[model samples]
Target: MEAENKKLDQFTKEVIQDAGLATPSVDFLANVMAEVSKEKVPVKVYKPLINKVGWLIIGTLFLIFSFVLTRFSLGFSILGDWDLSSLMLEKHEINVDIPITYAYCFFFLLIFVIIQITMISKRFSRSLEN
Candidate 1:
């Protein structure tokens, strides 16, 4: 066993001497850094189809529509029986008895959640594509 170990050590020394050591070029780091800087990193720019003003207008219109629908469904006269001027004024007692506002809020939240889920799904799909 001692003789075999000596022979293995001698063989290892000879193999290491034959392999020789290597040195990198002086410009190797600079070249690698230059290549890395030149590489194009994808910039994800989220450009929505509908702008902020358009979305605001759409949301305002939808809310108005919902209000009108709720009033009509609840057997209330549209702008006829409920005097907006008198309601705003201190003369008439404001009737805040509609339970449908909760429903409307819930519906709006559901819609927003669905839209967010769709947008997230599209973003993930686009990332996978890249």
Candidate 2:
């Protein structure tokens, strides 16, 4: 029995030695890296309801409207009781006096609108490029 066990162990060892070490192909790493670096299909992400150009136009219109409203509300008198022909004929001198707080608020709103417009346009351009 002991001789038979020894012979079986020797046979198993010889079989394992004959198999030797298994290795991957030489280009295995390069092939994996190439697959990892391959470009994928770009996906379009929807963000806002309006497009960049639409937002820009809307911002511009809002800016103009706000300026006109502010000017009129601040001091510029509307044609209330003056006849248009008489007012046009006479040399009219208009004076505009803007308070510091109002001026600051208007400027802040203007800056905010400009920044929003710029960001929207930039995002739109980037999306187009992708």
Candidate 3:
């Protein structure tokens, strides 16, 4: 059984070699030089201005949503009404200024506007420079 298995392995290797499917010879130095040459040249991909503007707007909207969700989680707490003096506490009180959601949304909207303005100004400056 062992001899038969060895013969089968030898036959398989010979068949693969005869099919011109043998492993390639190493060209280590040549491959390195080719890769180095490729690195020296920069590859450019062009995107239309409209597409980029669309993506920027979408990202700004997502940022605004996340800010609102975070504020909503932090500002609201609920508990059942119970006798205040039951636990022998002298006084109990809760103070909330404003709905956190509105404040957070407004703040982030302001920031998003500022960033957009800055980016636009910079882009215009670069265009003028060229």
Candidate 4:
């Protein structure tokens, strides 16, 4: 079995060497490039998954939900017979006195990060368009 395998491998090598290497025509690259250049390159237009109208609707719904929740918490029952008073959540207040300077620093850092993210996204979008 080993001898047969060796013979087969030798035969395969001989046949391949006899066939020699295949080469493309001198103008193969040029022809391919010419055809490629003639083809139309599709322009990709960026579309937001959630448009302005969608965002506006979402924000409006969020406000409405918040208002309803606030009213419910303040004993304003939407359902007349059913009482939701028992489901009232307790509000815990933490009295941690953070320094004014620390708050200011945090605020400024948040603003800086937001600005940086905005700038980077804009630059990235512009690059994609190009």
Question: What local distance difference test score does each model get?
Answer: 0.80, 0.80, 0.71, 0.84
Local accuracy of candidate 4 as per-residue lDDT tens digits, 46-97: 7899999999999999998866664465555657656554443544344689
lDDT of 3 by residue, 1-130 (tens): 9999999999999998889856555997898788888785443444457697799998999988766543334333344443322333234355568889999999999999999999998887776555
User: Using lDDT as the measure, which candidate wins?
Assistant: 4
Candidate order by lDDT, decreasing, is 4, 1, 2, 3
Which is the winner by lDDT between candidate 1 and candidate 4?
4
Clash pairs detected, candidate 2: none
Report model 1's TM-score to 2 decimal places: 0.44
Q: Model 1 over residues 10-61: C-alpha lDDT tens digits?
A: 9999999999998889999999999999999887666779999999999999
Worst 10 residues of 2 by lDDT: 81-90
What TM-score, computed on C-alpha atoms, does each candidate reach? 0.44, 0.33, 0.26, 0.52
RMSD of 1: 12.1
Best by TM-score: 4
Rank by TM-score, descending? 4, 1, 2, 3
How good is model 4 by TM-score? 0.52
Clashing residue pairs in all predictions, respectively, total 0, 0, 0, 0
